[model samples]
Target: MKKLLIGTAALAMVAGAAFAESHSVVRLGTEGAYPPYNFINDAGEVDGFERVLGDELCARAEMTCEWVTNDWDSIIPNLVSGNYDAIIAAMSITPEREEVVAFTQNYTPPSPSAFVAMGDVDLSGSVIAAQTGTIQAAHVTGMDGATLLEYPTPDETVAAMRAGEADAVLSDKDYLLPVVEGSSGEIMFIGDDVPLGGGIGMAFRKSDPEMRAKFDAAIQSMKDDGTLNEMIAEYLGEDSPAF
Candidate 1:
């Protein structure tokens, strides 16, 4: 009985001591324009839900994270070319993307990606706006019923739609969640397919199994500890985007 108790105590110690491996510096690339998910501040600091989550993941993994802000269009390519180690921006995992890079298992799942169209406006037969080079943009443009007007970013697309220069905008659900709730105006989810695959992930060049493992452990730790959802709530508001 004493031997068993000692063994149990040893196992408990091992479990308690279990922790994610740390990297010296995990370079995190963010769009720094997608509000609530990731964005830049007046101070030029990258700050948002993704930013908060990155910090937490670093803490959990015991790594130092270097924040890199750049345009959304270039983020994934930069990752593949080793310009940055990982991406924490509001990027979803899709089959096409999987061809170029690997993603950490999804940490936060979001509502389906779709367009928020005005109720009274006839949105059909009109050009839909979305950020250029985004998965949202591709989805909208490729849809059988859609005619797409591409913009540079989510903010620009929203502006064009609000100005009636475009019919509606396609985006991730959480990114538009704030605008929809804040406005008293009516908005509707237009299509059957939201978006396929799963939630946003930390992307890395394929074959970097070591780096992937580090991030996987880090993200899983955050999810298990509730750090991930807490950051999302703080930035994107209380409606959680758990894809």
Candidate 2:
């Protein structure tokens, strides 16, 4: 979902606040609702894998950073419009996105997308829920005999499936694993995994190559020292592909 927490008003407070004007603080933008990737903790603070990874990267880069949350759909445009600095959400590096913003080297490898449904659902002609503006939604649009139901958030896609509005929900396998395990046998994988995107990478405005380069070097440093792989396993799962 590249999705989040923090209200629109909070987002507006940072809109058009250029990070380029100050090297002291780098604002890291994320959809703070996606757990194991990024989410809001009980204390109402940003938490999860991206949070840990982003903080470490900032430390390595010797940059002071603050987290900002924004909705998934307008994330790119907001970055361009200077809502925040880097997008450290689970945004996959893709050609389409590259047209709008530059990317740091990937932090996570390509992971499979999967379908989850309530029992024995056949996907051939089923209605599938996917977050709007995601690769899963785009995939469903071209899938033979499948109907796409777009939701604004990842949680809503699952809600749609649970409410019988959609037969299945499609999203990153890592993201869906916890939901399935917690469903008390109500949900299960319904089909083969679908692999998409290059990998998850931090996004920056194209005009900020220097910023991109800074994070890229930090990511590469992590990869070299195996810290990135350690983080991938701890949060995404031991089976998650490593750097």
Candidate 1 residue-wise lDDT, 1-243, digit = tens: 000001122122211111224447878888888877777788879887777788978777667889988776666656655667787877777666666667888767745666777754444566788887766666666666768887777888888888888888877777787778776766566655364446677777665667778779988877777766776677766766542
TM-score, predicted candidate 2 vs. hidden true structure: 0.92
lDDT of each candidate versus the true structure? 0.68, 0.84
lDDT (10s digit) by residue, model 2, range 111-194: 889999998877889999998888888888889899999888889999998999999999999999999999999999987989
Error of 1 at 40 (Å): 0.9
RMSD of each: 12.7, 4.3
Alpha-carbon deviation at 109 in model 1, angstroms:
1.2
